[model samples]
Target chain A: MDRAIAIDVSHLSKSYGSHVAVADISFQVYAGEIFGLLGPNGAGKSTTLRTLITLLTPSSGTATVLGLDTVRDADKVRHVIGYVPQERAIDRFLTGREHLELLAALYHLPKDEAAKRIGELLKLVELESHADRPAKTYSGGMKRKLDIACGLLPDPKILFLDEPTLGLDVQSRLRIWDYVRMLKARGMTVVMTTNYLDEADQLCDRLAIIDGGRIKTLGSPVELKVGLGGDIVSVTLKESAKIPALESALKGQPAIRAVRATDKGLDIRVESPEKALPAVLEAANRLNCGVEFIQYNRPRLDDVFIAHTGRRIEETTPSKME
Target chain B: MKEYWQEISALTMRWVRRLSREKFSMLFTLVQPMLFWLIFFGNLFQRAADTQVTQAPNYISFLAAGVVVMTVLNNGLAGGVDLLFDKENGFLERLMSTPIHRTSVILSRFIFVMAITSLQVLVILGVAFLFGVRPATGLLGIAAILLIGMMFGVGLTAISMAMAFSVKSHGDFFSVLGFLSLPMIFLSSALVPLAAMPGWMSFLAKFNPMTWAIDAVRPLILSGWSEALPHVGMVIVVMVIFDALCLYGGAKAFRRAMG
Candidate 1:
């Protein structure tokens, strides 16, 4: 019942002159799981992926892909790993099929087998209709699909998708999400890095929340939300004057962990919203505070991020948010 | 070794395919050298027969070998432009991340540059023949010209690729390329013979590898193997040393960048 490790990065650090891009990071990706490095743009997510992909050497520590040392056995490691970098790597002049065919050759795939695989990948990415068109003529989503097909050409054991959905439209992003799920269904281990909290929550089996080149917390989406120890209860008051009284009354309840006043309401962190809702309502009634509305929110990945990093993911990546 | 060749062939084919698709690039690759031959050098030395600076029947015959060597030089030195674009666009990083033999990246580029330069050499030679210049050594001499051009080209291409990785931006890369290539072309015998240049210019030309390549190729085109064979031998030795030094430096720069 033991899970196999597809990627093992231990104490990996990378520095550029005086700037440390990745600082003493360690994590493991189990086979068949979509592991995610969740962080903002400068959080060393791409840097970690780059180091593991062997495009970069770590300043210290070790990383192994399918048990091959990324630095010493880079060629062997690369053989079993597929990497789709943040930037599109397709040649604009080549058709989608030509791009895949070229990559198959680079991976040393046999000619007939490469041809067959290219055909299959073209259909899989839904680019069969546009496969013969020059990549420059393809839409953004088509080009991205071709890029993913290129990464998948070698039938790699572990696939690294670095910001795979960055700069993509919602539909395009969803299409990539489906591809990632399909990859996982086929039992391919995927390591994806993204600043999108929803992407990490929806796609990843487990994720490490990274910020400032360090891991703030790591676990499954459900585990991370559960680890915050409660559901969130946002109670809006009819008047701002009711805030102080609601805050005191809510803090008195044993089910409630913490209470803070927001601009529009009182946010109560409690063990169970179902049990605490009535108690919160009772507390507000006793305090003579008129309740305008109450919203019961299960802790989101964003809340988990905020709990650990003291800043919302959106706040950190303001520019990148759609 | 088989895998090595496969990797090099695949990568080289990528470049070749890209070049083939760009009709303008293919046209310019062939035409640029011929333009220099016809418009600039051909016109400048048209009256060389009336002057004592030349020994050949006409200036185009002497300039034929120079044009071929110039094509090699231009192709080799500008070879890094593609690599620079690859670096800028992230394709180079993608290739580096693959299971390829790292040397294949540089070797494939060298192969691509040589292939294009060879074709350009033929086009120049063919055009030169129409203007009354024939290689005295026949097909064997044409083979020698390709060998010498490729030998000298390997070194220049390596150095150009090295600069592509070492520099920060496209502007810097092209500026450095222009700085190095223009001086090397003018100082070498690509435009005129060593006798045609002033004594100081000729002294510098002896140290120029392009000068040695021209000296080796010109006689095969104009005077046959009897006079050209020794210079061919000397040029081969010089090219090997030059290629070794440049390839070493280029590979080192590449490793540093990858790190």
Candidate 2:
């Protein structure tokens, strides 16, 4: 689709000494779209965000925000973008109102404009009552909301959020998700990095799954999931040692589309779980492997990550279950 | 240019607000040195200090200059503590992400430290007055004293900021702060006249920037401009060179750290 590009990155790579944090990666974020860079820990998402925001100088290639080169025109770029770092950046001594006030002044908002905007942000984050209290007293979720408010202070055309909801309760996470949707509705371009599969599935118009500083796949969540193309039958053997036997047993079957080995089980994609389940169990029984766990679901982002990387993006199964 | 100063002042006000909110910290920052050092050390050395060498009527008067300079030295060297904490806690990174000039962060700290140093100097002098010590050149001399402290302070504060950005952690910063402050204070003629120091230390004091400051400030408090002017000129020259090195090195370290 033809759309104005908010961010354009080409051949971007960043290194700390000899260690490459972000390898040659490139993508364009269209204006007014919620874009996501989905990756595991240390997957260079933060580095890429920092580079686009001009906190870092890329080791190679170039990035532009609204056509302004990130390095050559960083000052201009700073004017048009707001950043919410992964770290808790609020000054504990400053009240929430004071934090917004300072951010306003840094952004060079005029006196009247800043006051009005600060009031609006305080209200927006629902920190109005606690705005006068020092941030040290605010709960973790409240702090994260304040952080989002700070990023929104400049009313930036593009917002770069590094793990916006890294750690929070379900309610807080939902509030943040709603806030993100509101920003998108307001016609703001948001580029966020997260490892949460569901967050990407629910929030992003498009995503680039990155691993080991490389982009593994890039597509809309539905498009990528559909690209994987079937329902998956997850079978966990009582003994994980029998995984290879199950893998070979399930392979070359009539209805089994693909057999991908996981740390604890085998993910077998099939045209129908009904057709595949009986075949999977019969093979497992023949191989003397007890079926400790079995699950069936339509294709998931987890499957997409596994499909590309030959490994899981998240640490465990409960991450998806929860 | 206007926006730059506006941002700088706003950031400076942020530091000021933090200082003012903690009433206890504010009270101690203003009054602690007077109670701990000016009253005790000044009175203790009264009889032992020689009027001929000190060139002041009593030890308290001579000690006033030391206290003023000492306050500046301490405040200047420790100016970067808040900045270091900001760096550690990620506020500095957050601030850096904004459009404001990066130097504003460091410059604002300098402004805050020097401003506090001025108030602390006046408080010490007011208490010193109760002890029967008065400046020979009066109000103008007081202004001159403040200027000397700031000039001397600019260099020290810049060096402190450099340390903040250069070091790996706050623990490292504080250790270096202790390592530098004790030797610099003891080696300078802050507590005693140059005549009282051992030959080697006296020779070393000749090179200490703190010496140039104390030598300059002492005359302003104990003597008049004629004697104070030459020392002031020497300190101005010394501090210009000192601050130049510090600020240059500080800018470099800041860029490296932030990058």
Candidate 3:
């Protein structure tokens, strides 16, 4: 709605017959920010991103990229936006140089400028030496670097990377993450989706955690973690105990908000762990029960996810978003 | 207009480079038509030469012209299979997302196939000359026939691309292409003269546009024009209609892909 937002979607939904792939989702990504969509395998992250990129039409609602309607002004959107799909789509028979050249031609670049830009991008991605090798001969990391370079060829204002590092090794993944930071430094707005929570924490300035085609929560990594409270304490009970007794014992504690049974243990969300843990241990002692474990680390993204979804993100093997 | 020209130039250049890297494919394109020219048409003309069935001095000249057009049709229709592979492999999606004019892709492919088809025609004509069938239409007739051959090529290219979207696999698409081309060639006056055939075959040949094209070009190979011009006009009209149908079909496929 305002000048700062780079992308906006309202009540977007997509359905194939009776199956809903994405439903009633709304969010905005601001300019010059690395915004991330964090979700599990079938959380409608790709579908939502595809709709925003104008690859798939939404069944209802509207999406805008750079102040242009995705459906009505798709050509304008395509001109200014670059999309790096999850699947590697480069021609394997073409060399890295040829791939970039073909992509530049597709973008309608003048031949001289296209060649110049390809040279710069090759150097930027450190693939200059291997530019003449066919993409099929390049390692996975090299191919991915070329793919990124291809996406950057048009000098897009906002780029969408759908699982940019889905199957790369740690070193290659880190390299991609590093370039993403550089892209941000150059004032490019990037929208990325990944199942890897730590990637969102390390790379994204702000993130939205989505589940079952809905935004569960949105904020910077630290903001979301801090909002979940300061520290977490776990107690794996050997046997089930009286619910009322345990609740009453922990009631007067200063920072503890709620305690519930998790699969591995009893979990507690608290405002401050340093002051809350002593009381929790003392309560356990009085109940003649053992505190299996107590940890005083900051809340992780998994905790943030569990707080909202009432289930672990990894436990559900997502076959389809529908 | 300039931008469209630039896009066409760039697309055509890329394919030119691809063909250079794919020399084996060139040989493959030449062998089928060449064999058909030398073998089946060779036997038909040899018998016709001994007998007096055709009005033309040599049946080889007539058969050679038909073979050249048929080669263009086969090669051009297969361009659709290339497009289908491009789509299945994600190349088309990548292309559509870019800023280039979509029409340039189809036109460039048609031109690429035409260029190769024209060269194949030259080879067939050279062989026919060596076999004592001088091309009486000379350079002008050769140019006219090649242009018509290109029209035929563009028509088939567009139709195959349209079918690519509807078909499930590359193999199925090629099978349909074969089914479409073979019958059209046989039903037309490609291998034999219409005068020598049965009434039913002659009627079918009259209706077949491939017959029109062959009938048009055959006169040039035999130093005659009076009979060829009318058939040439008919072939041109039919090619335009097929081109329109294929263009509309390709556009529908694109719209479906978009949805």
Candidate 4:
């Protein structure tokens, strides 16, 4: 229970009889930071979130939010944490203003206070003009904005967003990210889960790369990219079968730290991928392998997923049960 | 408790706003019971020269109380289904993560159904008054109707939510709810007098909480508060027990769903 840690999950696990939804995952989200749980669907992200929000009791281990046990002090935890679920929470039958007003009431805001908060949230989400329209008439993005507005109705200490931008258009997704950043700027701790690597890289101050119900790695975007130990040289091959030839040809190079074949191409880990590229290209040309594409960039979270799990992120299908 | 009341009032108003927003849906909920009371009861009473022996005096009066009870039950039970759909659609989980009390969730739903059904009940009562069925209980009867209806509505809402929580899909929820509503309605002396039923049916009706409710309302509707006090006591006790059971069951279901 460190003062700076808003959410402290210690080996938290949740199982249903035989199926383990989240298995012994541990992480800490510091106060006033945007912490992302990056994982595929059913990869224990939602279960971890549910546990933190006190929606489910952990099968083993413990989690505390704002110095309160997520289980024992659930009511208190609930009071401080605002959860924006993956699905839209807007009651289509309710108008936008009415929706916000109802949520404001749920937070025990007095009539005048609730009205003020509703007005503020509606304006913040830019739905004030459509405040009186039924939510059913709202576009997907507007509904999403309203949903996020509802989450912020209580001005919580910490916010848990479960796939906040899962199905939204790019504009809506960025808009949500903007609000999440604003929340951070206002000293609110934010915990979000997403499978999108770009989102995690762009929005998260610190991120946990989760897969198969466990923490694969945890670091800031730059820290993780740096921790990958070197640059990433991705060479897209014209033929899938040419990967072995390319790997063998580059294996003896001292600059090539690691080599692996991906569906898209062969990835070479080196101290400096740009400096190593000429050698790699020479090897590929000597091996009679055609290179369709090549690039040198800092390691991606997906590369980290691959580096640790020995599997690509895109191919890692989430289990059906979770 | 202050927080609870605040949340409840807020949720209650939310439903009121929704009702206003979705006037067509409100009209549907409002018209079905009225139609049941007006057309079917009106037609039955029109041919009631011989049927007066079964209906006391006016047939519409007998049917009005029954329709009110039925409307409350249907709306409350189905409100749970809507809750389940909201869960499936992810609204409930989102709401729960807010600082709102868990009880407020149930209260809001109960308030919604009660508001909808109360409006419908008033419509039927108004039409009943027009049909020459005025009770001497006057304001007392209206209070009793609102009280009993609200209790029963909340109780049924709890049961429906419990079923919705226990079941995985709306279809299953509806199936179980439909199965329960019919027996509960039939066992109660809603449509027929308990004395006229067969021996076993009469015995079942005597134990049915619905029977107690209808009996309680019958006195208020027919001759004000002249009835014995035991029936009122029985109705209150049954309502208490049913509401407690439903609330307990519903809370358990909610816990499981959240998990």
List DockQ, one per candidate, in order. 0.69, 0.77, 0.42, 0.65
The per-residue C-alpha lDDT of model 4 at residue A153 equals 85
Candidate 3 per-residue lDDT, tens place, B8-63, comes to 87777877776666668757765565756655667665764633665666667657
lDDT of 3 by residue, A104-212 (tens): 8777788899999999999999999999977878888887898889889999999888778877889999999999999999999999998887899899999999988
- Model 1: per-residue Cα lDDT over B1-259, one tens digit each: 8888888888888888888799896686656756676557786778844435667787777778777887888888888888888887778877887888778888888889998889888888887877888789999899999999999999999889999999888999888877877778789887777887899999998999999999899899989899999999999999999999999999899889889
What tens digits encode model 4's per-residue C-alpha lDDT throughout A230-253? 887889999888898888888869
Report the number of clashing residue pairs per model: 0, 0, 0, 0
TM-score of chain B alone in model 1 = 0.94
Clashing pairs in 3: none
Runs with alpha carbons beyond 4 Å of true place in candidate 4: A1-3, A109-120, A222-252, A259-268, A278-299, A307-322, B45-55, B115-119, B136-138, B186-188, B198-207, B223-230
- Please say which candidate is ahead in DockQ: 3 or 4: 4
Candidate 1 lDDT over residue span A1-322, tens digit each = 3899888889999899999988999988898999999987788888898899998899999999888999899889888988886656778998898888778878888899999999999999999999988899988788889889888988999899878887788999999999999999998999999888899999999999999889989889999999998888888999998798778777867889989899977988889877888898888888888899889899998889998999877533433311
**Tens digits of per-residue lDDT for model 2, B1-259:** 9989989999999998898677797677645955578899888878987888787899888888888999999899889888988877668878988999978988899889999999989988899999988888899899988998898888889889889988988899999988998789888988888888889999998889999899999988888889889989998999899889888888888888878
* Leading candidate by DockQ: 2
Candidate 2: segments with Cα more than 4 A from true spot: A223-229, A234-254, A260-267, A274-294, A297-322, B29-31, B50-55
Better of 2 and 4 by DockQ: 2
Candidate 1: residue pairs that collide: none
* Candidates arranged by lDDT, highest first: 2, 1, 4, 3
True lDDT of residue A239, candidate 2: 91
